[model samples]
Target: MASDVHRRIFDVVARIPAGRVATYGQVARLAGLGGQARLVGYALHMADRPLPWHRVINARGEISSRGDSFSETLQYRLLAAEGLVFDEQGRIPLDRFRWDGEEAPAGPAGEGS
Candidate 1:
């Protein structure tokens, strides 16, 4: 029973492609929750589906550390598996990998076809 707000946020997150990423603020704005970036994070934390949560990062082009080293490491590995390379300071170059949110899939993979 995901709330409407969380579902909206998840929809925007699912649109982020495999190799591109979006910031929390960016996803929030796109989900029509502008200026509530933290809401995006909270929704994702409660997400149960296989949304591409790893594709969302902080506005500073780095993963938002949740103080859970395991999840943080898993996020880094997931992004790397999608061919994202981090700089020496462990930040992805947003200019090179940020999604423009123009090419959303019709629905989850294998749906709406």
Candidate 2:
């Protein structure tokens, strides 16, 4: 069973719209788990449900290396499909594509308002 923490993390991740991305730290903060960026990554790694996982990246606007070349390649392709352009250094331009959560459709989990 998914813990409340993981559930909350997933809920926040679900709100990340396509064509925009969130950093692990951003998702962590939005989920009411501020400063728990690594936890956000762990929750995502353990997620069984279908999530826009590729929409989450590192603080450097680059995909975190998973050591699985296929997954890394897949992540790049997935983001590209959503119209995200990576620079020659493989960094997504967070300034242009990062989701600020201002247009959030719903509140993050565990928040009343």
Best by TM-score: 1
- lDDT score for candidate 2 against the true structure: 0.91
User: How would you encode candidate 1's per-residue C-alpha lDDT over 1-113 as one tens digit per residue?
Assistant: 89999999999998787888999999999999999999999999999788999999998889988999999999999999989999999999999999988774555675421
lDDT of 1: 0.91
lDDT of 1 at 1: 83
Off by over 4 Å in 2: 103-113
Clashing pairs in 1: none
Q: Per-residue CA lDDT of candidate 2, range 1-113, in tens?
A: 78999999999898888789999999999999999999999999999799999999999999999999999999999999989999999999999999987654544774322
Clashes of each: 0, 0
